[model samples]
Target: MRPLTNTPTRYSWATILLHWLIALIFIGQLVLGFVMVRIESQRAAFELIQLHKSFGFLLLGLIILRIAWRLGNKAPPLPPSVGALERRTAPLAHLALYAFQLALPLSGWALVSVSTLEIPSMPFNLFVMPNLPLIESDAAEGFWAAVHWYLAYAGAALVALHVAAALRHHFLLRDQVLTRMITPSSAGE
Candidate 1:
């Protein structure tokens, strides 16, 4: 069977590496995020939460680099089998991720930075997370906290859709659709 897109030209090796790394970080974020919301805002829990936030911020940096790389490098075109609906949706999906990956952390940063939770953050006494420097009022912090959680929920939903689609392409479609992104380098894939 023929591939849907042209020989994958969209992602460079560096892009592929960062994509997978981001995926892992996002999965970790999901786990820790659940804990942060459901569990009490205890110091121990805060430690774990800080780990997630730190990694997410790292992802933030990488996502920016990935965007820069994508800007510079041509991505592999979608396979021919990819339908028009998918063609339209996929780009939006990627863009949504780019937006969320940044917004999610920044929102969280604002939340923790502003909230009076008094959690000991950052690992191994390395550094204290600098606050956003808000007024000692509840309304503002509460607003951003709500925004942070709401966005986290939205980002979670997007991840679910993203994974389900990948599985659909891999197992159901039985095409190189997933491989188009998973493949190591442009030349090899």
Candidate 2:
């Protein structure tokens, strides 16, 4: 087999941009979640939640673009040392991540839409977002809430694994798997 030293293995420019942007948004969401939900009385907590929701919507739209980009462009292959089991599971895990990332945000968005009370204030009073149009029932609202929570839990769990696996590749395997995303080659860069 060919050696996998520093071989360019990363998404296209657009794909990488989307990947990093979503990551940043997710990080913000995680922090906002801890602060807003945990310390309920803090000033600006509601606003922070709105910020989180808006970022989630951004992530939702970007995710669709990311999926479309993935379909169009061939993704870079796994690095040299990735086990066969990991190679297979990576795609499935990504699939799950994308699904959850999209579902949870959209569900939360829908919850706001179906809510009887005034939706929390967001920037510019442009807070209300478009709904799915199909899922308009109160039951659907509850269902989406459940989906939002469960998927968020699953996504968080997977993120831990994702980070651990990257660490494994970086420290244990001494491979360039993490480097691929971190530093693209001169060609890709």
User: Evaluated with lDDT, which candidate comes out highest?
Assistant: 1
Off by over 4 Å in 2: 1-8, 120-128, 134-143
Estimate the TM-score for candidate 1: 0.83
lDDT: worst 10-residue window of model 2: 1-10
TM-score per model over all chains: 0.83, 0.80
Query: Cα deviation in Å at residue 155, candidate 2?
Result: 1.1
lDDT (Cα, tens digit) per residue for candidate 2, span 70-175: 7776667887678899999999988887887777777778776665554553533576565545445677667766766676777778777878988998999998
* Regions more than 4 Å wrong, model 1: 1-10, 39-41, 117-125, 133-136, 186-189
What lDDT does each candidate get? 0.75, 0.69
Q: Residue 146's C-alpha lDDT in candidate 1?
A: 85
RMSD of each: 4.4, 4.8
